[model samples]
Target: MKPSFLASLLLAAVLGAGGSILLTHASPAQAQTSTASTDTVTIFVDATFGFRKKHMATQLTKTHAEYAARGYRYVDMAPYNENGDLVGFFVTYSKQ
Candidate 1:
C-alpha cells in the first residue's frame, strides 16, 4: 500500500464520520428551542389489533374525552403500517 493512498483513506474516513456526527447531533440552542416550541404538542400511538379490535370505537371515544378534559385536541393522524398492511395510527394532539 502506498503512503499517500493510506493517508487519503484515513482522511476520507475522518471526514465521513465527522459529517454524520454533525448531522445527527443537535446543538444546545436548537435543542432548547425545539423543546420550548413543542411543549404544547403531544403524540400517541393508537394500535388496533385482533384482541382490541372489538373495543376500538369505545376506546377512541374515551380517549377523546380524556384528552378534551385536559384541553388537548386532536390535530392529525397518520396511518402506522407494518409491512404492507395497516396496523395502527400515529395520532397528534395539541393544546393551546
Candidate 2:
C-alpha cells in the first residue's frame, strides 16, 4: 500500500474513534438539558389489544391531572402504534 494512502486511512480511523469517545463521555446532565429544551413534559403510555377509546380517554385525563398536580402546563397529546396490537400515547407538558 502507498504511504500516503495508509496515513490517510489511519488519520480517519483515529478521528472516528475520538468522536465516538467524546460522545460516549458526554455528561448525562448535558443530555437531559438538551432533551428538556426540546419539550417540557414527556409521557409514555401503552395499552393492549382490547383497550377501548374510553379507557384511553380516562388514562389521558389521569395523566393530565398528575402533570397538573406537579405544576406542569399541558401541551399536546400524541398517539402512536406499538407492535401489532398495542397503542402508545404521549402527553406533553411544561413547567408552569
Candidate 3:
C-alpha cells in the first residue's frame, strides 16, 4: 500500500472511466443524418399455413398488388417446404 502506487491506480481508473464515457456517447451534432440505413426489408410470410385459409393463389396476388400500389418491388421469394410440399414464403421487397 505505497502512496505512489495508490495515486497511480487512481489516475488509471479515472482515465479508463473517462475513455469509456467518451466512447459510449455520441455528441448532438454527430447524431443526425438525412440518409436512411437501407431501402429494403425482408418479410417472412406464413403462406403455407395461410394457404388453407385464403388458398395461396388468391392471397398472393392480392398482397402483391397492394405492395405494387405502394411503389415496392417484389425482389425475390423462397418457398419453405414441409413433407416435400411448399408451405411458407420468404420474400424480399425494396422501395426508395
Which candidate comes out best when scored by lDDT?
A: 2
Supply candidate 1's per-residue lDDT for 76.
72
For residues 1-96, what per-residue lDDT tens digits would candidate 1 score against the true structure? 999999999999999989855543322111111255554444433444343545646755776687688887787766656566544455566664
In model 3, pairs of residues that clash are: 48-87
TM-score ranking, high to low: 2, 3, 1
- List, in order, the clash count of every candidate structure: 0, 0, 1
Model 1 error, position 34 (Å): 7.1
Residue 69: error of model 1 in Å?
0.6
**Candidate 3, residue 2: lDDT:** 100
Model 2 regions more than 4 Å off: 1-39, 49-53, 82-86
lDDT of 2 by residue, 1-96 (tens): 999999999999999989855543343111112254554756565443244545766766877888789887887766755345435566677777
Ranking by lDDT: 2, 3, 1
Question: How far is each candidate from the true structure, as Cα RMSD in Å?
Answer: 10.1, 10.6, 15.4
Q: Give the lowest summed-lDDT range of ten residues in model 1.
A: 25-34
In model 2, the Cα lDDT at residue 23 comes to 40
